[model samples]
Target: MSVSGHLATITSAEENAFIFDSVANGNNAWFGLSDAETEGTFTWVTGELLDYTNWFTGEPNNDAILGEDFGEFKADGFWNDLPSAAKASYLVEYSTSVPTPPGIMLLMIALTCLILQRKRIIFKTE
Candidate 1:
């Protein structure tokens, strides 16, 4: 089946680091950030609140000549603005719903460990 996914919208340092280590591979990759509509109004493609940012020093500097508007993760794990059509790797987040709050990360981890154990149910009642 065809699944729908959106470009990654990073909201925390941990998420950014996860994306970097998991897929960025120290190379440039586009995420779900951009100011294409307004000159300086950046928003996530998934309609997430513009809460967290990891821009590199003096970055986004939306170049007047090149018209940089899209957000990309640089090699150093920081954000930068680039023009559309830039040939770079990209990440897609398959959340399929609102992004989860970071506060639930530990709970998710614990549940994942339980799943990995592959323990079968010892009792069942109907």
Candidate 2:
């Protein structure tokens, strides 16, 4: 699925295992799947296709006292249900299409002009 600029939408078993291996810090984490809109209908925050899942057995049970709508992809390559307010580490997916901020873009252009001018002077002296 074409996911960008949002929380990770892990779409394959290989990716899931890789992520778990990278972050096996023994801490619960949230991957931003929630059924806040409709019960039992978990969707990624980025709206990417729900093509894969690693749910821990009997989990996403929505069994929390307040309700378990949020998803916590644990360190053990399994997913569990939690509430949105629960504390955990989060993963974000950045998009290359996200444009540079105007200020940064301007700074880059100015730097490029200065470098070119320096090169021209060096070449003339040689």
- Please list the C-alpha lDDT of all candidates, in the order they appear: 0.86, 0.81
**Weakest 10 consecutive residues of candidate 1 by summed lDDT:** 117-126
Candidate 1 colliding pairs, count? 0
* 46-90: candidate 2 lDDT, tens digit per residue: 787897888999887997577889888887879988877778887
**For this target, which candidate reaches the highest TM-score against the unseen true structure?**
1
Report the error of model 1 at residue 37, Å: 0.6
Model 2 RMSD to the real structure? 7.3
After superposing candidate 2 on the true structure, give the runs of residues whose Cα lies further than 4 Å from its correct spot. 1-4, 98-126
In candidate 1, the residue pairs with backbone N, CA or C atoms under 3 Å apart (3 or more residues apart, or in different chains) clash, namely none
User: How high is each candidate's TM-score?
Assistant: 0.72, 0.67
Q: Positional deviation of 56 in candidate 1, in angstroms?
A: 0.5
**Evaluated with lDDT, which candidate comes out highest?**
1
